[model samples]
Target: MDPPPPPQPPQFSLIPPSQIPPPQQNSNPNIQPDSIPNWDQNPNLTHYLDLSVPKKRRRGRSQRNSALFRSPLTLNASSNNDLSSYAITSSSSSAAVAPPVSFSSIRNPPPSLTQSSSAYDFSDEIIMINKEPKTEAMIALSAGFPADSLSEEEIETGVIPVIGGIEQDKTPTEPSKPGVIIIGAGLAGLAAARQLMRFGFKVTVLEGRKRAGGRVYTKKMEVGSRVGAVAELGGSVLTGTLGNPLGIVARQLGDVLHKVRDKCPLYSVDGKPVNPDMDMKVESAFNRLLDKASRLRQLMGEVSVDVSLGAALETFRQVYKDAVNDEEMKLFNWHLANLEYANAGLISHLSLAFWDQDDPYDMGGDHCFLPGGNGKLVQALAENVPIFYEKTVHTIRYGSDGVQVIAGSQVFEGDMALCTVPLGVLKKGSIKFIPELPQRKLDGIRRLGFGLLNKLCHSCWWSPVDCFSGR
Candidate 1:
């Protein structure tokens, strides 16, 4: 019978031979009975078969199914040793079947290890393969995985993955330069902005008023046929030409400066011209009294109680008052009023200790006036600088993270903030600080005095002869 069908190979099964069900007989006439192994004959034969040798290759339908469900054996030594240690146990089954392996399961192994037959022995290779795909955290935790292997959900939520108990931020660092917010578009603020911009910083200036120049205001006067002359309603004169900031700006703009002469024509309160000789004598006496007061302050040294400059000057004036006539005394009083005007405050409020402290730093040379008002200098400095006007910043919230300035309904954020607002504004509490200013600063602001100066510009057409003569 076809040479005894070449000894049909025995089928392997985990189940015992007695419990295994017999195979169904093939009904096809073309198939010979000798080709199929009879399970009834010698049932215990499969028990004695060697399992160490790999299963024989099959053909046709069985081969195709085996290829699809076959689990791959890792060629590592540890994996081979672990596989060899596994004990072969029999179950109530016809043939040995391997679990199906998926592509993802092979690529990303499970985190847990499989236990071998021996107690306390664990297999290094992950055998508990999941049917479903691996998750993002599992893939990231796997060794040799790329750093950017974050899931779509993690990326969208900006969640950084934790590896080995340490969280890592994979986002790239920002390359842009820092930004600065400057309050008040005054000269100080504008100058700082320009300098910062040159150094590659982004700057924004917030100004409360409609125009710049801060307290330096210039107004054009056109009063009936007088050639439109510009009047300085605020700061007008450049105190010194040598080393003066405004002087430098004037030179840059190619503008001319007018020097003011030290000539004063005194007039009595009764509208009578005073003798120039008497005017000179009183002025000298007043200056001598001021020098004497300064010397006295130096001699007295530091005192616990502070006295007003006016009080000290008055004390010195009594000694000199006996030598001058009443008209000359009136001229001296006028000089005192001029001194108050220069200080921009009443002599009663001026501090005796620090009233003339800044005199030594005064720029030497001629005191000059800019012809078109100092507003031109402001314009020159403000060129190309982005200034937001009427942005009255009412609140400032600053911290290590940066600063937030709230101007009306608009909010501005920057890496740093510069406050160039006048001390008067701070003292008035117009702009509220998130954390209130320090007690010391508040005390100083309260102690310091701010004075107001009012100017009245007159447009008069009269001849010098008529003006000087009692008109």
Candidate 2:
């Protein structure tokens, strides 16, 4: 027996990026009871989340070499606006040149995170992480490779030879603060940087992508000479606006928030709308499934064996067969498929045993979507921080002293580091770690899986429909 085809992952409806479904268009003025809306060749229909294929892994030296290189770079911080850093590359042992590279720019900045005049202030109390807790000022622990790994010859000649006037006087000032280095400028990384900055810690963010936002992306439409429509290519909705941090930020930014709900108009293949009776049946099945999923315990005092939703759904079918007819079941299946979007994976991967173990957050409010995509939130949070674009981190070395990050051709050192790279990237092993990670951490990294969700945006169109004709 071919091991009964692997359980298919749950499927989610491909909603247009804006969650704005085009209304059915009909030529007939007087619509018939069975008249279905024609969606064939609809130009306005957009495919929001296209999970047709798996995501491709990042390529280049980071994926291949995965080696660590420590180079001393020059930082010109005299003028905040003209602050730029450069890395030197040597051709032959004879000579090389250091190209001027603009690391980051500080434009008209946002309000400070706190009452402090600037975001780079040090407090009396020292904050340390992941080592013997010490209370003092700044400190830098050396983070070089194992002594045995480096040859004596290589060690003696490791200093990057400067071909230009790039060297600056190593003037000793008040020992600088122990800074933080954040890899990946995605939402999570940006959020961490923002919080750390608010706490008066220096932070430098390295982003592989040109833009700041990672998963949160927005695409703008343009007409012949002017901009037209706008839609989100990633992260469309905020599940609950109330008590949601992102929602709060959106509201503060003066972005229009549209309230959305679970209810949506349903039509059959021929455009015939599902009758109220059938709709009720679909809703009942969905509710029952939710109830069953919530009941994590088995009969009496035994623990329930966790199974995929597909498996438990079969049990539901036996119990509620009478209430759900074939037609209704089809509609229910359509609704159930939407779970894929929420979970970002197949139902088989979801565990019924600990589904809701992490105290889910639901404030009983309408789902909201920011008219201006989530990229705005990313931009807002990335203010005042130095972010190096197109810096793909290849390896990280952390120890009692601090952390050193090597990305592309640049090297960054900091007091601590926050690795916000997606699990997919981590699983690909694109990055190497010095001294290696613990077995348990490695196991967790391998065990957990990441999913892919893509979005496509198109023009928006709308038409009206009436579902009461059958009644």
Candidate 3:
């Protein structure tokens, strides 16, 4: 008979409760709330986009199809709140919710490597003729297993013999809790989470809505391609370099691009064909309006107030009066609507400073989604991450020791947590934080305005070129 094989170290196990403490929130006046608009305060002008609504049934068939199967999926078009922004509130320790029941008592699975002595022995599948290195032995054992998800115990001791996939004896050294708690699951939150995750701290992302990818919705519809495709119902344009990490990641992992047509025929506000040359007049007038609005924002400097894009355009009416056909105003309105969606709100609400930071004019080529939509990037980010659908993180607590995160009454512990919630939620005082954040951080977020940028994704079929006023 063959001799018995060598023994391996203990396998990974969940963190014990004795080591964890009760939940708490650190809030005070020092952590002032953000002055930006809240989600509830935002408006929904895009109701016309939802075809399922009873009123939309009145539209013609072609218009319905065009809206439903719109070429550019509205995913990530930001059909979300326009009053989005982060805020930090000051408060003394508030009420602490009970810890998740299964948090501490959850049983850890038996060590995979510590099974019965007579169990099947792990065999090595050698690729090379003579693999003598112990590294090779370790690699052979680690096949088909996740390395990043391993426990701290496994990462440190390294002695645990690998079993089916994980090192049982090892446990992750819990991460530190963060000062600030963020809410929402938008691009901004994702970017912040990605950055903070790199640090040795934990983040709690409290998302009020059931689904993630806030405003960047990518729904799979059975249309477009043979197998059907994912379509966007929100913001569809991505311009500039740094402001568009999704564009880069898409090209790298998905090898996709927004294939914008060489030229989109100009249309009158009333949907009539128009000459692109005349668009120069439109662009010229629009430019001045933008410039004036930008200057207004700079002058205001603080405290957000609302402004209307339509009103701004009114000042330039006389400039195009000579070319004014009956449909000129309608054409102008349609163009303005598309631009409004581009910014997700009126230029008046848009922070010129933010725009400059996100995508400076003439800096790089503007980007759009693949025929499917920008949801591809969100799907890619979620591929390996351990995310729960419909899961909502409620409270976040961090201290000198490890981090604690509460989601839908379930508390999860980790060496470090990365809170990737949107700034809007943070501003609203939705989730509680332990150890009040420094005033500097609070002030930064306080001043950082987050206005809502909502979009409605649905479609309207082609109606008469002049539906309202007879042509």
Candidate 4:
């Protein structure tokens, strides 16, 4: 029989906790380091990007497998608040003395490895790591894994390994808490930050746009003699009231939300009211088309093929040629336009398989909307959260230690990072990943479609002699 395989080093998981300590506003009145820290004075900050450790080819299957091990520490953040940047101090018994390394200063390296700053700054928080010997406990502890998560042998040894180039902490009493970096300051990002902060995480939000409200925009309009009025330009309505996350938040924030009125008056091209019988016929035709499309979609699913709703509608129109005339067909198309309007996409691009997907609670029928618009939702979530705006993140690099985000010349580092960018932006391939994403994920990104919906809000003056005069 083959001999038992050699033992492998304990794998370190760098999964960031949901929360850390809430980030307190920077209390240092004299110092303002909101943007990238001034690294010119301390060139050592640039060394953080260096991979000086030489690579070696491993011989056996065991060594080869170990070589392939990659840490899951890739916390990617966008242009914004991610986490607290702290100082990192390292020391060795063999080397008589060495300077402490700052996590923010990792981008630079000093000319001499032996030289280190003699003065210690306790005010600058340090990530404490014990330096003894490489063991399962050490790797687990360094990555912030709980003691119970380890095995019996790992618990017994309690050895701590020192990563190369990075020195161990002189004091191990106070271990630095993990932090999370959130990209995007929209509703989801801000909401995530709020929850994570409550969980005791130091959270930072980065927004590429100047404002926090991602796609939720509210526009104000004032016409000739009319007073001010607001219109929802994005994400207007709440699908339901019961168990609706947005509705719950609106209630907590004391915002007014009313159920939308479903009634709409139909008129002819000449501005005359359409006959009630013609309206009923148009409505009936639309309903029939929807039913036909559903059946066609079911049949297409059996063949493992997907088609657009527009394609299905055309097929329905072809089959029910005598049901409606050209004018009636146009009216039916107008009613069905709501589907495209709601999705901000055309039927030609919408997937028939998932186009009708919606929450079952919504079927109960009352759709609600905020009079002030969805921007109120954004404001409620972004409260107290620090957001860095206008910083376009270009790249994210993660490893066993932490994640580093690069936007322009600035670098934001944290234990974990969350990306809340729009699917449209991600599909553009503007931001690049370090190791590259898997093929299936990239394929999904391509398969998924993004749509654009335009809104034009304006006020018009009506005179008695105008079209209304005919009524």
Strongest candidate by lDDT: 1
* Candidates sorted by TM-score, best first: 2, 1, 4, 3
Per-residue lDDT for 327-435 in model 4, tens only?
6755665655655655567667656555644311121225677765677778766766779999888887877788888888999999978888888777998778776
Go through the candidates in order and give each one's C-alpha lDDT: 0.52, 0.48, 0.39, 0.50
Root-mean-square deviation of candidate 1: 45.0
Runs of candidate 3 exceeding 4 Å displacement: 1-214, 223-226, 240-243, 262-270, 274-278, 288-363, 398-403, 413-417, 434-471
- Supply the global lDDT for candidate 2: 0.48
Name the better of 3 and 4 by lDDT.
Answer: 4
- List the candidates ranked by lDDT, beginning with the highest: 1, 4, 2, 3
Off by over 4 Å in 2: 1-176, 296-302, 322-325, 460-471
Global lDDT for candidate 1? 0.52
TM-score (C-alpha) between model 4 and the true structure: 0.55
TM-score of each: 0.57, 0.58, 0.44, 0.55
Report the alpha-carbon TM-score of model 1 versus the true structure: 0.57
The TM-score obtained by model 3 is 0.44
Q: State the weakest 10-residue window (summed lDDT) of model 1.
A: 57-66
Instruction: Estimate the overall C-alpha local distance difference test score of candidate 4.
Output: 0.50
For model 2, residues 348-408, the per-residue Cα lDDT tens digits are 5655444333222222245777755576787776765579999999999989998989997
lDDT of 3 by residue, 162-192 (tens): 3345543322245454433444556665545
| Model 1 spans > 4 angstroms off | 1-176, 222-227, 322-325, 458-471
